[model samples]
Target: MALGREYFEPSDGERAFAETGRSGRSRAVQLLLIAEQLSRRDGDELPTGLREDAEALGTPELRRDGSDALRGEQRARAVAGTRLRSYDAGLASELWSAARAESDPGAAIDLLGLSLEDPSPYARLSAILGLLSLAPPDGSTSGVDGYLLARLFDEQYRAPNATGGLARDLFDLLNGPPGGDVPRIGAVPPAPLGSGPLSIGVHGTFSRYGTSRVAPSHKFYGYLGEEFSPDLFPDETRFFRWSGRYSRHDRSKGARDLPLWLHSVGGVGELDTVYAHSHGGNVALSAAADGVRINFLVLLSVPPIERSLAEWAAIKQNVGYAMSLRSKLDWVILSDLVAGRTRGARDLLAAERSAGLDFPPEADVHTTAPLGWFSHSSWLDKRVWQSTTIEAEVRNKYLLTHPGSP
Candidate 1:
């Protein structure tokens, strides 16, 4: 079915099933619900296997009662199925695991496509990552169905949000020529650092999919440079472009490469500050953990994944000063909690904190919610940059001060 439909409310039986602690049975119900939802969306009758499973599971609420009760039964069944498919965290985790484990590319593609409808942003993010993983190393889209490719593009245009933009870029990569492999550690040589304090911008994940110059994240970096460079930084502002892929492997490589690149330009001591958003922040922190001592670090909505806690903790020792700007309404980091459950413990302990991630005690934390900036990308907004509060923080407090003066 076309995505972005209103979420269905769960019935008493469905809620009871979830609370029963029968994980195996719950998964079966979830699959049945997903099958039913997909079948109905495709204008097809309910599949026999799903119907049989519903009967076997004794989930009468998920089966059509009778012809006379068609409307009510359909509603109940659909609601039950939608709840299991969309709202169940365990189910979402299972979907990701299944997509990763599936051997057949075609089956894996179908599973990933279904996962896009999940309410958890992590699941949707995983789906996009799975698609990229399935793409041919040679950059050919030969095995993928043309209709599915078109549908993905349609979803991208319809949503037009962060995840949508990511999907669009992935679509471009699938359709276009191979961009070649991700760079190795130290592959990118350091450019000349001009005479004054240097400020560097590193963009978040999915940014490397399309042209680096025109990406929204890149544009945001450009805006920051133009808006603040003249007064805040007398020297030069530059962007450090990395793979921007959503994987530990790529991020670890970036962490190593960032230090190598900076050292070539006279090390992090020469850097006045580094501004990074989302996973970009992780890269910077990971670099600090690897001994890149930074004068200042500004993190925008970086997720506190369990694997990155050590890097976050390292900031106190490796960074002279750190500032984190976050929005309370940033759902992307919440997705990290949901998706991280599959990996291990959830890193962010509290949901009420800035960006849902905990920062070191030495770090300065600010929430954009009071400024009416709620979206994950609100920090990138020109209005946020222009606000008096942010002006005081960035211009007067952080940037205007000498390096290491928090």
Candidate 2:
């Protein structure tokens, strides 16, 4: 242990020596990061080799106890709230940072004011049923209400595409003060306020949303949940279907059902978390050609829209490349999208390079992807991207690009 520390730890002067490729990444920092992840995670999730290393390194406990994990959260909430009550808005920031280092939602909410606690109305409703956590003793001190989140059509809510979810959560909280006169802020979408870019955003490939002219909860049998209206062309195009026949949504098997069901849908409010401008960028390009530079900023997971510019080929081929290549610049997070090491983070980067969008400084192009993607949200988790360490790299790069990320 001492030898490992000695070789890995760099003194002030040692860093200078290593700056010119004399040393690689610090082993000390690497080990510390691994140790932190292990500590942040449940013991059962620790890799076998990591478990052994942890034991050698003097971790107090290395066994999984489901009860202990739940108990810890409960106890921590109770203790921390009380212990840090007097600490102002910035309570032991370092301590919270270390504890929630691997927890993006935590940092985003408590540290940064965003939470996945009530990600969707359905999830929030389920959470109210004790499916997630017990209800708070009082409604006033309770977390943000799901219904209150519906109103983010306001312009002040945006914070670059990087902190999209965080900004949304803030709007929810703003709508629901401890006891506001409005009961709940009637958050009408910005659409009602105006006519242009600030009002609408686009995203896709979400869970099968059951909608009918009725209440939008009917399983939308026989029809796909994602309905796409091709630019001005009218047709009832479906993006999701169920079972052998279109069936009621069973959340348990939805991921598997995506490809089979995904037919088409306009990039509306669904992918708002990722793709915020120009659903698939086809319209943006078209709008751009007419001298209306659409502010396209994408942070999506699915492959780019295929054949987006092509008039209509049933299979929808080459649209992702077409939109990317045509754009002046595309800001993409390429980590999970590529296939291999030698290739880049985005599968389309090489193709874009061939088409001439790939630049060195990244200022010339309209479309740009960071080298990595953020991790934590199940939909945005790093594990989803098998290619590389996308979570950190992409987030940091975009963070650098986005000036307003409070």
Most lDDT-accurate candidate: 1
Candidate 2 Cα errors over 4 Å, as ranges: 1-43, 46-89, 97-236, 241-372, 375-406
User: Over the stretch 88-184, how does candidate 2's per-residue lDDT look in tens digits?
Assistant: 2233233234333443323212321211122222112111111112212122222222322332322124323323433343233233323211121
Q: Which is the leading candidate under TM-score?
A: 1
Global lDDT for candidate 2? 0.25
Could you tell me which 10 consecutive residues in candidate 2 have the lowest summed lDDT?
A: 335-344
lDDT of each: 0.47, 0.25
The alpha-carbon lDDT assigned to residue 371 of candidate 2 equals: 27
- Per-residue CA lDDT of model 1 for 1-406, tens digit only, reads 2212111122222342244342322332333233233223124443343344334433332222233233323323323344355455545454334432442222223444555454443334444333333232232333233433554576566654565765565455445442322454533233345545667766787566534322334565567667554322222233366788655556667877775666555543435567778888878877776666666777777765433455456655667677777654244553332232220111212221122345544344443332331245657655555653765676554543464544
